[model samples]
Target: MNTHMEAYYQKRSDIYNHVRNASTYEKIAYSFLMACFTGIAAQIVIPLSWTPVPITLQSFAVMTAGIVLGRKYGVLSMILYCLLGLVIPWYSGMTGGLSVLMGATGGYFLGFIICAYFVGSISDKFPKSRKFIGMTGTLLIANFAAIYIPGLATLYLTMSSQGVSLSLSQLLMMGLVPFIFGDILKVLASSTFSKLVMPKEE
Candidate 1:
């Protein structure tokens, strides 16, 4: 906060002083907007195989959210998204609640937080990487770790608790392999857009 603002009657610096607050507000507002957009993306779900887990746009939005918002804002946006699930019904098949966040696919939702944080951190660290390849790598690795590890673990636990049996290959085929191509695409798009919009460092 500024301690004091001198009035420059002729130059009109007083009128421009509010820009700082407006910029801050604009950032927070954009975070909420990203939250809502990601929530909407989650609504388009496609079921596959006998498993309960289905492909959704949630991951794509998560990649974009992290790349675009950076660490602090990205995490804030996703947490807002998690909370908004209470009343917005933004999860797959239009479902939402504390229950869903703790359900079989809850790992994906929870992983979004970790993914966004690390991905954004990587982007910040290498903001000007050549053609943004570093950003793409960051996003891809984050997604892989976030979704594949936690997601498969949760799915395994959920299935095991329900007395289901599957080989390791089966688990990889069913849970991890299917999403690689999609995640790569999301990473590319996220990196490109983030690079385009991000301001150059001084």
Candidate 2:
């Protein structure tokens, strides 16, 4: 059993090395592609009447980018997505601009960058995380630490700026509670996809 575990870890390490040592052009290409994927995912939105935060596959795409691209390029992809979003109407509801970045969901947008980095770093550091269980666990933590925290804080601040003060429970209802089940599904999907796309040792 120990020998099998060692061999599995070695295989995962080989895959990580391949991704880490990818050519600059390849890295850039993958990052740009992920940025585009995130934009496309953002278009699949389910707007709710009660909350400004819409349900979208953006988080899944972001998590996938991290797992597939590793930390450096994953962060690059998110940065590209966010920066270009300011000039293109690719955000949710076909909206974009600086205003979008300052709106209720702005923190979630920022959280994407942080999420990508956090997930990528973990995947890169822990070769075992390439497996489904590990990847799912990592993404779950990343969702709350890197996404929901910033999202809820931003929601609170944005609402306060508009003279709409809400309690912590209320904030959670708007930004966290409604999305828990969906986010779990997203994490599972992202992990499954990552297991497929992440390199395997030859």
Candidate 3:
């Protein structure tokens, strides 16, 4: 078991090293491709029973991009994702437009840039496979701040603009609480996929 485990990690590490040593253009191209994939992941949506926020594969893709692409490329790709969202109608619920982006949920979409950077940055801190997966999963909670702070704050402001009363507790119940289990599942799945697909570092 130990020998096979060592061989598995060795092969994963070697592939990672080769990818890392590739030309900058190649790396950027790969990251851009991953970014596009993440955008598609965003469109895989499941509306929730209680909240306006749907459960999408976005967080999974966003988080995984960071870990796989590293901070600089991860963030770059997400920014591209955001710009593309403006015209492509690929935002949540198949919505788009700069107007849609600047509206209530823009924060969440914008947050993906920060999310990829922050989560990818921290996940890169670990060296071993076990540490990488565990640390990334643990860091997912902290990374939620990247998503929620802007999302909830803007949501409240948007509600106020329409003379709707959306309290903090209500926001938590609707936006945060319900997504906890699903997000955890995403984190775990992404981390596990990382273990099989790539090395700890980009």
Q: How well does each candidate superpose onto the true structure, as a TM-score?
A: 0.81, 0.88, 0.86
Candidate 2, 145-196: lDDT as tens digits: 8998899999999999999999988898889888889999999998887676
The order of the candidates by lDDT, greatest first, is 2, 3, 1
In terms of TM-score, the best-performing candidate is 2
Candidate 2's TM-score: 0.88
| lDDT by residue for model 1 (62-181), tens | 877776677788888899898889787988888888878877787787888888888767755665641367677777788899767888888888778889877898787778787778
Among these predictions, the greatest lDDT belongs to 2
Ranking by TM-score: 2, 3, 1
Q: 93-155 in candidate 3: lDDT tens per residue?
A: 778789877776677877788888886666566545335457455447545788877777777
Worst 10 residues of 1 by lDDT: 11-20
Clashing pairs in 3: none
What does the lDDT come to for candidate 2?
A: 0.88
Poorly placed runs, candidate 1 (over 4 Å): 1-25
Q: Which pairs clash (backbone N, Cα, C closer than 3 Å) in model 1?
A: none
